[model samples]
Target: MCGIVGAIGSRNIVPVLTEGLKRLEYRGYDSCGVAVLKDGALQRARSTSRVAELQEQVQADGLGANLGIAHTRWATHGAPAVHNAHPHFSHGPGAEAPNTKPGHIALVHNGIIENHEELRAELQALGYLFLSQTDTEVIAHLVDHLYEGDLFAAVKAATLRLTGAYAIAVFCAHEPQRVVGARHGSPLVMGVGGVDAGERFLASDAMALAGVTDQIVYLEEGDVVDLQPGRHWIEQAQAGEGGAVAHVRISEAQRPVRTVTAHSGAVELGPYRHYMQKEIFEQPRAIADTLEGVEAITPTLFGTQAEQVFSQIDRVLILACGTSYYSGSTAKYWLESIAKIPCNVEIASEYRYRDSVPDARTLVVTISQSGETADTIAALKHARSLGMEHTLTICNVATSAMVRECKLAYVTRAGVEIGVASTKAFTTQLAGLFLLTLTLAKLRGHLNAEAEASYLKQLRHLPAALQAVLALEPQVVAWAEAFARKDNALFLGRGLHYPIGLEGALKLKEISYIHAEAYPAGELKHGPLALVTAEMPVVVVAPNDVLLEKLKSNMQEVKARGGELYVCADGDTHIHAEPGIHVIRMPEHYGALSPILHVVPLQLLAYHTACAKGTDVDKPRNLAKSVTVE
Candidate 1:
């Protein structure tokens, strides 16, 4: 995953580009750089650290320009070093120039170039000198090789020669007022700052342009855009016979610009120590906003065609990855038990590569916080190719690629989640999925009027329930104190809570750098019990359901292994504290909505544990908030 931001304006654009990089930092990056056309030459600054360090380097060197491209790279083809940082340049047929010298082309790229080996060899044979071990550098050299006159034409021709996903922003020293960009299999969007403002912008996500511009144009696959001061144009590329390069034709395309109110203020770390902590505490309001104005559950709540789509579906196929995959797993239990619909959840990255039965009548639901997840979008397309065309998405971003690809969508109002480890987004997705389950149950005549009324009341009370759960943070913090001293964690749950346990383990490992694993309580004797010792901390999600007795039996098994148990249990579970056993009583026992409540304490546990361990709670190592590249 990476981020790109470009601006062509009259005023000095250094601050705009750097601030855009700061906004996109949540996507995760190992290195950052900016290339700008200053005084008819390319001026660049790069750092193998945070964007703040890059900004310092820029200020110390007095780097400023009217037109520029910036990038935050999550290393894919190269190591996280200064040479591999983006804003790579090429000098064309001339001798290689110094870093501060005039350059023919400067480029920033987001996705992988799959055919770079061959391309690099060919460019090298043509006498182009390479500077960095990145596929992105090859693109910049290719653009320089093709540059006869126009930067836009050279970028278009370069895209025709490339094979793989990319969202690139390029600028030429000769064209001081222009920046060209193109995308294929990755996301790119244009921002309009109005005619009077005299600026046009490009970014991988609209959030990068927050507070600068509200208007956005989402570029489709194979679209190339030319951005100049106060003006822009888009061209769509159509493949010829067998998708050959010789016959590729370009035609002008009209992409509608929509006004999106970017939440700039939401990115601020208000009173919380970290974005993760703030997001965890915001779950109550997030769930409330996701469920607002829902007096009753109906098929149309998803979309206008949801009623027709729900009536035609016989089963459900959930596609997602990461935390979204866990949310989908939890929904499978709800859809099968409550709605009487057979449901199967698949990891998006693996689903497309494996053979599976794809029925046309099956409803395909995708879940993602950012709609731009590359694997999920590709999997959705793969399912559609196999005749599973009835598609729906539960995502946070309204303008994300997932929403555009799906026929129906339930947009979660989680605001902007800056933390790499998801908190509010996961809860909001569960809220949306539960609504879908209720709607399907009603459609199948499984939910009577009284049942619907009762479920609606429970849905309305979720905010208050989540609020009560957050009150247990102080208790969770106490448990975290004991957990901070350990290096390993084991989470145990039964039935629906099993996925919740998995999520808890994921949170702990992602932010705290602890090696954590989760298993169904009954699976302890199968293999995991052998790893249990006094050094291992066991977390049990013990809701007062039918599985409580069985879960208690599992807790006894852990106790017999000399393991310390940290349990989040209901007040009336009758499970009390004993030697090697610690219990944090939950506020109340929510029947169908128990998973939503149980997950909050686990999140708080991970948050406080990471805090005690002094790990980076927002940007976890080697993890990107949005997985844009597969």
Candidate 2:
């Protein structure tokens, strides 16, 4: 995944493009570049550094243009060098070079082109030379060959020959007044900026449009957009009714552009050194916002139709990816134990590739923060195709595609999560899923009035409880000093807490770049115990549940092997800080909600460890904030 931004206006758009790229840097950070239509040609600057360096280059070169496109790349096709950065142009030192001026359609792209090899061969036959080893370069050359003095027509023709997920922004020196954008499986949004006769801005995320414009338009799949100074139009390829073999027809339409006043204030990094640290500390407010007006647990907490859907369903199927998948796995323990519903969790990317029996009575639940994850959306559609129509989602963005596609939704009010490793979003998702579990329990008659009230009381007290857990950050920073020196670590838990261990390990590996693994305590003696040594740090999640003594023995096995143990035990667990074992006592036993509290220290541990290791905690290497491409 990469980040793309384009703007067309009367003002010089170099600062606009650079600011948009700065906000979108979470999507990609390997390299960044900007191209502007200036002085009858395209002036471009590329850097193998961060967006800030690219901005400095733009200012130092004094590159100015009325319209431009910028990109921040997460290298998929080539190395992270200046030569491989975007925005890419079509001219190179070969037959493709017609001795023309610069800027023969400069383009910035987001997703992968699966058919680039075939397209490159065809373009080479036309005597077009390629400069960079990126699929986006092929697109620039193709658009250059097809241009008939109309930039939008040339872009539309080029996309018809391409296959795979992409969100691209194209600009031409010949048509410096306009910029064209197209999307297939990736995300792209349009915004209206400026005061009188506003400018048009396009980006991969709304956060990029913050403080510039609150009026936003989310593009749909297969939508091609043509943007000018104060106007825009859209075109879609309409297909005849023959399914995949249908004849395709082109149709153009224009709607009154609706503007949504986005909450841009959430994007600010207030009083924190890094966005990851700020989000980790914002957990109390995040959880409080998610459970603000909940007085009781009922099926209606999800939606009005939730009761009807739950009554007809006997099994639950959860589809998700990455951190969301681990949240779904945690919900499995609660869904089955409390709700008495048989539940299964599937990795969204793998679920659609295999043949499996689907039941009509199964409730399919999709979990995502952006709600634009391509694999999860495809998996949800596949389940629907197999006769499972009852669908729901626990998503953070209310306007995201997953929320629109599902029949019912629970939008988590975690605000905007910008860090690559999710913090507030994950905990808010657990809170939402816990609410789902309680609702299903009540519907199945598994939870009586007294039991429901008790769970509600615990739910209402979660914000304060999370606040107390955050006070343990100083001690977690102490443990992180030891972890910062280790090359590898093991995370251990059992029962409901095993999924929490998995999540903890994921956070550590994602942000800190540490090699980490998680195993159920019972599985330690089987194979993983051999990797235990004095240099290997073992992090344990031991809540005061039924598995406390069992987890203690697992801790003993690691200590016997000369491994340093870091435990986040409950207050009553009796685990003390010793010579070989380090303990951070939790405030209280959280019962079924222990995973929510136990994960806070793990996040702090990763953040502080990455800080000590001198790693980028906000944007880790080779990782993007959203997996928009499969």
Strongest candidate by lDDT: 1
What residue runs in model 1 are displaced by over 4 Å at the alpha carbon? 91-102, 194-197, 241-253
Model 2's TM-score against the true structure: 0.95
Q: Write the per-residue lDDT of candidate 2 for residues 263-375, one digit (tens) a residue.
A: 54237787888889999898899999999888998778788888898889999999999999999999999999999999999999999999999999999999999898989
Per-candidate TM-score against the hidden true structure: 0.97, 0.95
Top candidate, metric TM-score: 1
The C-alpha local distance difference test score for the whole of candidate 2 amounts to: 0.88
How far is 466's C-alpha from truth in model 1 (Å)? 0.9
RMSD of each: 1.8, 2.4
Candidate 2 residues lying further than 4 Å off, grouped into runs, are 92-103, 241-256, 263-268
- Candidate models: Cα lDDT each: 0.91, 0.88
